[model samples]
Structures are given as structure tokens and as C-alpha cells.
Target chain A: HLDLHHYLLLSTESSNIRIYYCFRNIMKELQENFKKLLKTERVPVFLTSSGTGAMEASIVNFFKPEEDVLIVVGGKFGERFFKIAKRFGLNPICYEIEWGDYPKVEKIEKYLKENKNIKGVFIQICETSTGTFYPYKEIGEVCKKYDALLIADGITAVGVYNIEFDRSNIDILITGSQKALMTPPGVSAIIWNEKAHKRLGVNKRYKYYFDLEQEYKNQKEKFQTAYTPSVNLYAALNEALKVINKIGIEKIEKNTSIMSKATLKAFEEINLKPLSKNPAIGVSAICLPDSIDGNKLIKFIRENFNMYIAGGQGHLKGKIFRLCHFGYIDIFDTLNQISAVEFALNNLGYNFDLGKATKKAIEVISQYKGA
Target chain B: HLDLHHYLLLSTESSNIRIYYCFRNIMKELQENFKKLLKTERVPVFLTSSGTGAMEASIVNFFKPEEDVLIVVGGKFGERFFKIAKRFGLNPICYEIEWGDYPKVEKIEKYLKENKNIKGVFIQICETSTGTFYPYKEIGEVCKKYDALLIADGITAVGVYNIEFDRSNIDILITGSQKALMTPPGVSAIIWNEKAHKRLGVNKRYKYYFDLEQEYKNQKEKFQTAYTPSVNLYAALNEALKVINKIGIEKIEKNTSIMSKATLKAFEEINLKPLSKNPAIGVSAICLPDSIDGNKLIKFIRENFNMYIAGGQGHLKGKIFRLCHFGYIDIFDTLNQISAVEFALNNLGYNFDLGKATKKAIEVISQYKGA
Candidate 1:
């Protein structure tokens, strides 16, 4: 389920020490790397979930049922925030954007102005379904204007982007271990600034196991989790974060940017069009030609190379495919995927030059001059 | 903190299948083993929390704040149930028993008879602190008489004891992964009969992440957890349970009884008294002489032999030491620990016959004729 390298896998093996090790001490080392990578001094609490749990955590812990929250929906994850909020008795006002379109800051500010009851705003840094990264900082500022907390689902964004959370008005940032953090699924993190911590103690409705107050008390005071976390993933996260810091987050982000650029350029070299107007740079979403079945193309790639390129979710299903250049994927890996897609499309009778996409991918990769 | 074998460790190393594998399929195999081991047809739902979380889950899901619950407190874990119940606003009517003492079934019946509002009964099958095993089946019968749900914490008891849950009237049985299950500490399982399942959907207060309805929907219907579980621990648990099944729970319990009987005999050889009247076969609590410091004797054994024999908790601290013969520990391992204790007690100037404990242990172990 996760593309984990041996370095991170070896870290998971050291998790036999969970019974003896200080959970906070392990996080302390990893947090330093997180701070260095994200350029933030916020406290991060790790929960045993694959991003969805943490997303649910961010809502149930911080927002009350009596309060209104504004959720900017670009894709599937946005819908998740809206649903979880509704499930817990919160009044969620959804502001839906096109699947591949970025949520506008002015529209959010207008919503906040019109609805003064909004206590918090939820948005994703990267709408994972469409590979569209929103300008969360701009939206964060809008929430700041209304004195509302801005929670960013940075599941596919955190480690791949050079996010300066200290200055970015985002009060909370959520990430999954299986994403850019390079660990397998089952561990998710919620990094919050002082604002989110103030709201943490309130709201007890259906919130025992993921209770932030208990988590804050145990994690901050006793150096442990409120519940038993996937201790192996913490070890894996520490190792992965170390790798990110060693290669430098800037260097990793630079590489991801190169890969993303090359991939989009390569796909465009063929007749396929880029799906997102504001692409995430962590992943590329390309619209498949109606002639070729997206599922068939994905299956061919999976069966041939054992690599997963996701077909779309929701209404976009069978119309587009998401190519992930995120998380430890080098330029050569991107080229191989681009070549695979080209080869598969050609064999399926979709008119395209066989080697042109790979040639264009190399051309885009050669243009990178960053250190 | 846990004594794990290499077999379980190797099992944990195969857990790279979180995103793709059907969570239900994994649990289906495990639930079958659990059914055979516990001799029950009840459903076992695994959560990514240690035993305490499951205890909190028991309180939050089944009983509401208005409902009175009888909690039989003998030691630390029993106190945990009472506290979790109180914290969640459940009226926990505590029936306190002395450390190293069993909870009387007549007293529990007396309490249940008086408290008509009591909706549930909570008790540990074995109190790990004092190594005392309560008559949980008797307690379950009392609950059945009163029509109250019986929740048993079988943390260190389950695989060590041949429990027949189908006939025992235990509505809910909770166990930790690190205990007799032989996995690491990140996962906990809660098995429930039909009676407990009927009440699970009623409670919603402070129960989001550990919400039973959500878990039931996903684990029972969807074949996955409501949230991401520690996939590696589940893999490890499957392997550990397989080993338990192969050896057979009856055989494991037989070995445990033999080990317990031998160790108690060995300790009694040196005038060390076994603490509990109804001692669990899983572990032994021994009262050290007033002249010997429990901490020093424990420290000496730990430093010299790298063996950990825990000093007591609460009033028993410095007065007794608990010896665990639980999990994957074999006869020779029990003998080694007995010999270490004898050696350490002598070094601390406690007058005892050298090697007599080992001799007595050998005599007791030699008498075991069970296959």
C-alpha cells in the first residue's frame, strides 16, 4: 500500500522498544526534523490512522456542534470534512469548487463575512483526488480576518512542499504517514499552533479515543499518547523525516517540482490534457481520452510494472487518471511512468507518438538548475 | 516491557498490505482462531489501542451516564476501569477487593440485587498487579441473573486460560496484543456476544474514534476498521494466534499451570510465600521476607541475569514481587527466573538454602504427565 524504502522499513523494525521508549522522546527527535522540514515550531500529535482519522480528529476535537464551520470542497477529501462535521452535529457550510479548480480567497472571505457564525475553516493543501493544490495561506488569511481557525489537510502536501507554517495563518495541518512522509499507512499526524490548542480542551461529544485534551495531557505532559499508537510508524516517521532533512526538504521539494513539471509536460506532448489548472506539483492529474478506458490503462500499468497510477474518484472516475510523482519518486521514475502510459495508450489505438512523451519528460528534467 | 519471540517479530515484518488487503479477511481468520481459543462464536473487533483503551471503550459504548455499573476493583487495571467509567460520567459503583485477593461472587450478587439500575458489570479475569485470577464466570453468572452486561478484561488471562466464552455468559471480553496474544502493544481486541452487540449502538457520547457503531459497521459489514488499524500488529497477532492454536490453548494452559505450580513450589522451598489464595496460572505474586528489599532484589536480578521480576504496586510495593510465567515462556525459562530470584535473594543476605528452589521446581515440573 505504501512505497517504503529499506531505510524506513528498518525503522519500523526497531519498534519493539515501544514498551520501554519514551513516546515523547521519539517524537521530540522527529518533531525537530518536522520543524526543519516544514519551517514550523508547532507541536505535532501522532494518531494511529491513515489521514482520515486525523481529519476526523481535527473536526471533532476543535469544533463544537453549536458552532458553524466553512468547508471548501475541491474534491473527495473536502467532502470528507463536510461529512464528518455533519455526522458529529456540526453545521457545515460547504463552498464547492470545481474538482480541478483552486478555492478562491475572495469567495472564502465573502462566505466568512456573510456567515459570521463560522468558528473554523477547513481546506486541503492538495485535493488528492484531482492533484490540485489550493493556496491555503491566502485562505488562512481570510480565516484570520474573521478570527476563525484554519485547518489544512496537508496529507499529500506537507513533506513535498516547503510550507512555512509559522507564518502561514493555517492553525492546524494534517498529514498521513503513507504519503510524502514515506511511512506505510496507519499513522497520521496533526500539527497545530497555539490557536488550535486553545480550542482543544472543549468538545467532548463522541470524542473519547481521539480526545485531544487527553492526548495533549499524555503527549505533552507524560511524553506518550493517550492511546496505544502504531509505535513502529513513529520509528518509521523518524527515519523518513531524517532522510527528508538529510537530502534537505528544499532539495526534495525541488526534485518533486521537477518530476511534476516533467510529467505534465510529457502528458501534454501526447494529446492528453492536464486536469488541474493549478497543479499540486506533488502529483499530476491528466484527463484520459474517451476512447481509452481509464481502468484498463491503470490495470495495464499495474500488471506490467506493478506500479499503481490511480483512476479518478467521484464524477471524474473513468475520465481521468492521477499520476503521483510524490514521495521518494525520482525523475527516472517519472520518465518510466510517462513511457508506460505512452506505450499503453499507443497499444490501445489512441493516436500518439511512442517516444515523444519520454523525450519531452527528459527535456523538462534537463531544465532544472536548482541545488 | 514485553517478552516477545522472533516468530511474532517476523510476522510483523510482513505488514505492508494496509491499503489493498480487505481488513475483514485478516480478522476473519483471526476471529476463527479466537473463537476456537476462547471456545466462542462471538465476534472479535480489533482496535488500534492498548488494553486501557478497550476498557474505556467498554464503558463509553455500552453504558450511559445515567446507568449504574458495578466495577470490581482489585488492583491497578481494575482502578483503570473505575476511573475511565467515572471520567465518562458513568456511575461506577466500585466493589473493592484487597490486593492479591479474589472478588467474592456473593458480595457481587448482593451489590447487583441492591442496585437495580446497574446496567453492566466490569471485572478483570486476572489482576496482573497481584497475579490473582477472579472467578469471572461466577461474576458473569451473577450479571446474567441480573440481566446486566458482563465485561471481562482478559488482558493477561485469555490465551493463558482456556476460557469458554460461549458458555461463560461474558458479554464482552477484552485483551491486549502485548499480553498472551504475543504481539506488540499497539493493538487491542474486544470480543462480544450478541448481548453486548445489541447495546453498542445506543451510546455516542465522547466515542468518535472508538465509536462501536462505526467500528461494527466497518469491521462486521465492510470487513475493515472504522479507522486505520496497526496492520503490522494484526499480522503479528495472526501469527501468534496460529502458534497458540497449533500448540492448542488447552496445552498452553496446561503448560502455564505446570509452570505456575513449579515456580510456586520453588519459591516456597526458600520460605517465600505465594501471595494469592486463588492465583492465576499466568503469573505468580510472591511475598518477600521483610529483611529483603524487593527493589534491591529485583535490581540485582535485572542487572545480573537481565531478568525482570516486577516489584509490587500500591500497598504491596517493596513487600512482594510478581513473577510472570505468561505468553511464550517455557518451563526452562521459568526455572531460570526461579534460580535468578534465589540467587538474588541470597546475595541480599536473606537466609535461604542455595539451589533448593531449583530442586523443588524440578521436582514439581517432573510430575506434569499431561501431553
Candidate 2:
């Protein structure tokens, strides 16, 4: 299938007229569909890079230099906001938390109350590094009470969960083409409310490429971007988003939840412990015993079973492995992942029930009736 | 073809280990082939965005705040450099020139002599906005003599022309995937010599997404990027670069030259004057008669002939139209463009000989047989 698509569209001129026209409409329609999916009136701006680009765009456009912003750092993605804010010369007050923990609304409120100049609170809805699903809705209420904008990185949380943008009062919501969107990476989407737009008024410090205002203006006027966008990627994303919309966000959420639950259940049957204190539905981080090598286990699974999963990032390396149950995945995929893990563990000389894990996963997944 | 590839590989998890492993080798091989195609020892850094991202990466990574740089502004891209430098707090001296005119090397030398603190000279090898190709080799010499870093935006130049990176003394050279690289617009490639790398030794102003040093380090260590790249785009780019390598750069240059010649000849037959005095080989900017509206002409071609061409940008809008003969384009495409223009003009009641343009085009394109 990859070869087929590559043969058809990959060889065309990058700026082909047909592609430009088709993608222009695709981008416009995609944004509209994204608004519908988020149940928001605010239009999502499509950026031509990864989720990190959207994160930086939000910081650079909405906040002023040296303006105090509160960053809730629980995992790697949370740390990203801190780094981007610092790079943009924003005064970021880090509200640090443990890697696998979630941010508390009270703590965020305390930070806001103590710091009168805090203009915004930056955080991740799902910290992919540790598979923790943060309570952004509660934090949003705190930010609202303090009149501080809430910028949530929903890269891993958007399509996997029901992210009602307007209802949740998220001023700036960001996501990427990868993750639950089920498209290849390259484009990121950022949807912000009028309050965030007002805050970004007349900003002149942003570089040409990342200038959100200019991109917004261009997109508004011509359904185009500030730079040459990836037309092929846009076409791919349009189709992916259409599939998600057809499946309905609620169904997707339920499916992802079921998969996550089944996978966790299977892991428990095999005596594997979940790593995150508050794990997200899209991925489950399983803590490996100190005696077992997590890296070796992952490598063995990839080599022997032809299955791939994530290893722990940063400080948690070699101690945990991540199993994904995100977009384009179903119960069968979850069972496969569990079986692979069981096989890998047994191959690594760890005592684990081989067939018991898959059986447990199947039992849990069998209860799901909704499509 | 696009459907096939999309069905197979486009739906995979972006950070999947198998995808990561496969694309890591693809990225490495693509860069190696790119270096060979450029015939330079300098390594090209694969950036996960459009060329504009690469342009910003160069500025924020190499120059410090309030540092002085010289920008030769002849077209929109040149103005982009000016804007980026200002955003990074650099004091940029704009050496302004007419949009269609090329910059003189002597003038650049004079500016460098007068401005002793100028740290770098930024210019575009082929400014896409006006189709003007500057004499970068001469400018590189001037920069070398004055000990100023030469940063060239080669977005529309690299694959279309034989740009000798090392011998030409170019400190920094940048290109995009959408232009001559024959790939979708997502990734950008930047190749720089030791001088530019040494200048970027310890700069930290760039955000995580655009941090060139970290990206370079990561790529050098494990053939990986600092971010999750678009795996499908990389696969497509690797294949495209392999094709380019097989054809050889010199032959591609000749083919592009023939196409450009054919286009210009066709334009001349229709009594349309070339807009740029020193137009690049990739595109031709044709001045429209005052009686005929350029925008209407372009729209007519799009609506009637179903062809895609560019109209004049910025101040030149409604005055000129652009004809692209860039990557993945051939003599047949050039003929089609000329025919469309002729058809559009004749249909719009502009008096011109029918079939004359294609005849003139064929006469010029027939001389090239190397490809």
C-alpha cells in the first residue's frame, strides 16, 4: 500500500496545480472537521511541522518576552514547554511534579494566586513520556479563575479522549498529525480561543516561519499557509481525520479505553505492573523488575516476534516499556502486543504465564459492544 | 500510487520503533546521497519542516542578539532573511535591489568593507518570488575575502543547478523538499562547512524544534532526529534522492536549462517579456501587457486549461505571471504550460498566434538529449 501511494502521488511535482487546489480544499475542510471533532467554534491552525512546532507557536505568539508563565512539568513533554518558554525569553515558573504523577488544580491555583504576573499555564493533557493523563479540565477552571490562559498540549490525548475544546475552557489546544490522528507526522494543529488571539495581538518578535498571525491571516484569506505546506501530508491527514470523524469521537474514545484496559489487565495477569500513577488510555507504561533488562526485552520482542513497543525515556530508561493502543489499533492489536510481551519476558528467562496474558486481554475486550 | 502507500505505511504510529529503525537508515542514506549529489564533504542536516524553518535555524543557531548581518534583498525570500534576523535581535543591514535585478558582487564587497562588524552576508541563490538567480559564487568569494560567513538560501537552486558547495566557499547552504528535491514540502536540508559549524559552537537561543546543534548531535550519534520526523516523507525523499543520484546533477541541470529555454522562447513568441533580467533556470517570470490583467490571466488558465502556474507576488501582483519548470518537470510539462498560456490569452481576447508558442518551445527543447 505504501508503494502504491508512493508510486501515484510521491512522484508528482511538489507544487502541482491539481495538488495545490485539492489540498487547499482539504486543509480548509480538515480544519472545519477538526473544529467539529473538538466541538469548538475556534478554528484550528495547521502548522507544517511536528507537535513541538505547535507548542512553540503557542508560546511565541500568545506570550510576551519576560512574561511570567506557569509550566506544569510532570514528564518529558511538560519539560518541553519549560524549554520553549525559556528559549523565547519568557519567565517560566516551573510547577514541578514527579515523572509519573499528574498536576493538581489546587497547586496550579496556588501558583497563580501567588504570582500575580502569571499570564498563562502551560501543560500536557497526556504526558506521553510516562503515560499519565493530566486533569486539564480542573486546571483550566483554576486558570480561568485567575484570568490566566490555559495552553494544553493534547498531542497524545486529543483523538484518544473526548477533548471538548470550548467546554473544557482550553484557551490554546494543540495536537499533531501522528498519535490518535493516525496520520504520518509533518503537520500539527493549534486551536485557540479569542482570548488567546487578543493576547497575541500585534506581536512582532516571532520568526517568519513560526509567525502564527501571518499564517492565520494567510489561511483565512486564501486557505493557504505562510510557507509551502506538505500537500501530500495534508491529503493523507484529511483522509485520516475523515475516518476518525466517521467512527465518531465517542466510539474512538471507548475503543481506546477498552484496548488500554484490556492491555493493562493482560499485563497484570502476567505480573507486570503499570508504571504511571495515573495512566492514559492511549498507552500503558509497564514497569519491569530491576532484575530484568527492559531494553533487552524490547529488542528481543522486535527481533523474535516482529513487534515493536516504546522504551522508557530520559530517567526511566531501562526500567519501563510502553505499549500503545492508540489510533488505527483495535483489540486484536492489543492482544498481539500482550502476547509479544509475554513471549519476550519468557524468552528473557523471566517467569511469566505465556498464554494467560492473551486470554485475559480477550476476556476484557469481548465485553465491548459499541463500534 | 498515493493511495497504495497511504494505505500501507501512512497510518502507523509516528514513534513506533520499527518505523523509527527503518526511517533512521533511510534518513542516513538520503543525507549521504544528498552530500554526494552536492559533491561536497559537508553533511546536510535534515530538518522536519519547510525551508523557512531551516532559514530560522541558521540564524538563531549562529548569530547572537544585536550581532550585525548583511542581507541582500531582491525578492520576498530576501525580505524573509531580513525579518528572521530582526526577530533574533540581529542588526541587519538591508542592501536593497530591484526585485527583478540581481545583486552585484562588487556592491556586496563594498558593503562588507564599510561595515567591519558584519558577521555574515545572507542572500538567496535563486529568489523564487522574482525568478532572479543571483551570482552566489561571486558573492561567496566576496564573503570569503571579507571573512564574513556566506549563508545562501538555495531553495529553488540546489537540485536545479550544479551548486558546488565546498569549492564555491559557501559557509551555509539551504534547500527545501518541495522545490528541486522532488518531494513534498515537509523536510528541509541544510549543508554547511566547518566555518559555519564552528560559528554555531555554543549558541542556545533556538527552541527545541529548531535546535540545529541537538539535531546534528542526534543524527551523528544514531542517525536519528531530535524530533519525530514524518516517516512517509523520509521514505519518499530517500527514493527521490536515489533517482536524482542515478540521473546525475549535471544532466538534471541541462534538462532544467532546456526546459527553461523552451519556456522563455515560448513566452517570447507570444510577445510576453521576461520579468527578471537574470532569471533562474527553474522558473520564468513573464510580464503581462498593461491591457491584460495578470491575475485574470492566471485564473483563466486555471479554470480553462486546468494548469497551475504562479502569479506575481507582492508589488508585482496583477503585473506578471510565473511559469515553473522545476523538479520532476520535463519538456512536455513546459510545452503544456506555454500552450495553456497561449490558450488562456487567446480566449481572453488577447491577439496572439495560436500554436506558435509550442512550436518555438519544441525547437528549443529538442536540442537536449543527455537526459
| Winner by DockQ | 2
Residue pair clashes in candidate 2: A1-B4, A1-B5, A2-B5, A4-B1, A5-B1, A5-B2, A5-B4, A5-B5, A8-B1
> Which residue pairs does candidate 1 place in steric collision?
A206-B206, A206-B207, A206-B208, A207-B206, A207-B207, A208-B206, B24-B223
User: Positional deviation of B53 in candidate 1, in angstroms?
Assistant: 3.5
> What digit string (tens of lDDT, one per residue) describes model 2 on residues A1-371?
24534523664745465676666787788778888889887877888899999999988888878899999898899999999999878899999999899998888889999998999999898999999998888999999999999999999998889888889979999999888888888889898988888987444775568788888887877889888787777767777777888889999898899988888888888788898888899989999988889999889988887788889999999999998888877778788888888888888888866789899888888877433
Model 1 DockQ class: acceptable
- Point to the candidate with the largest lDDT: 2
The docking quality of candidate 2, as DockQ, is 0.57
Candidate 1, superposed: residue stretches over 4 Å from native: A1-28, A204-206, A226-229, A314-316, A346-349, A369-371, B1-28, B220-222, B274-277, B288-295, B313-319, B347-349, B369-371
lDDT of 1 by residue, B140-161 (tens): 8889999999999999998899
Tell me, by TM-score, which candidate is best: 2
Tell me the lDDT of model 1 at B239.
Answer: 65
Give fnat, all candidates: 0.12, 0.60
- The list of candidate 2 runs beyond 4 A from truth reads A4-8, A368-371, B1-9, B13-16, B367-371
